[model samples]
Target: MTLDDLTVSLRALRLLAADFGHLPAPDVDVSTVFPERLRLSFHDTSCESLAAFEQWRTALGIAPDAVEARTQSEGRTRVLAAETSFAGAVVMLTAYADQSAADRAGGVR
Candidate 1:
């Protein structure tokens, strides 16, 4: 993935966290990028859980179609979605967080 792709992915995950946190405790946060890993559980990764493996796979696979792209800061912040395709199709969403800010404030996410 390019730097641009990594940014898009970051914003997408931030959005996902905000959206998902409303469900319950054990909020899912953006775990990693480059390879794009999302921590699917609050428990340990090595725990011997029957459904953990499948859950992890599902989190990485839920890209929505029509990956929309948008900028947040003065052309610095960028966001993306895998929603370019029609509904029911897989979204290959991706993002970029602004590196510098005049006020040193990060974008809204």
Candidate 2:
């Protein structure tokens, strides 16, 4: 996805959040070139939001197609990665542990 594509995708997510209200707000950073990496870092990971995204992906039947991966987790830190396509664009949801453990993990997600 190009920068423009990234913008449109984020707008769609924001709109979806408005409707469902459980989707976690995204903090995105994108590059302008090809081989775009759309990394969505959710600082405040909530169980409800994670479940909502999982259910949404499963309902779309993309869960199986979606790649499930794990991030580095140790101590009191936890990280999860769920990759699913949205509007034909590859979207990755990365959730880090709660605020308290963020420091030790060094924002590992």
Candidate 3:
């Protein structure tokens, strides 16, 4: 992430916290591995995570269908993700958890 990218990410986090104060705080990460992207993740059950992602997506004005949902870790983990540009910086909001945990919690598969 560039200096501008970090700046944009911080600004976005601030806004997100202010606007979605009801939700749990996300784990913020900025890495060169993702280049210009800033990743915000929530470690929760699949259902809870998806709900949080949807809330953020809606608040950011992204279309409901503009998301990529997939499974990883040999289908042990379910990942819900959406991307949006904030002040020219790529911001990725993700929610992921172990499928078994969600299953025990009676959450989405």
Per-prediction TM-score, please? Answer: 0.26, 0.48, 0.70
Q: Among these predicted structures, which one has the highest TM-score?
A: 3
* Model 1: per-residue Cα lDDT at residue 31: 31
Ranking by lDDT: 3, 2, 1
Task: Encode model 2's per-residue lDDT on 8-107: one tens digit a residue.
Answer: 4566455446664654455564444523345565554444444544554554355544545344434443455666555544556665544346554575
Q: Model 2, which residues run further than 4 Å from truth? A: 1-22, 33-37, 45-74, 98-109
**True-structure Cα RMSD, model 3:** 4.0
Measured on C-alpha atoms, candidate 3 has an lDDT of 0.73
- Give the per-residue lDDT digits (tens) of candidate 1, residues 1-109: 4555445445555665575544323333433343344333323222222133233224545434433545555655544433222122222333334434542364332
Distance from true position, residue 83, model 3, in Å? Answer: 0.4
Report how far off residue 27 is in candidate 2 (Å): 2.1
Better model by lDDT: candidate 1 vs candidate 2 = 2
TM-score of 1: 0.26
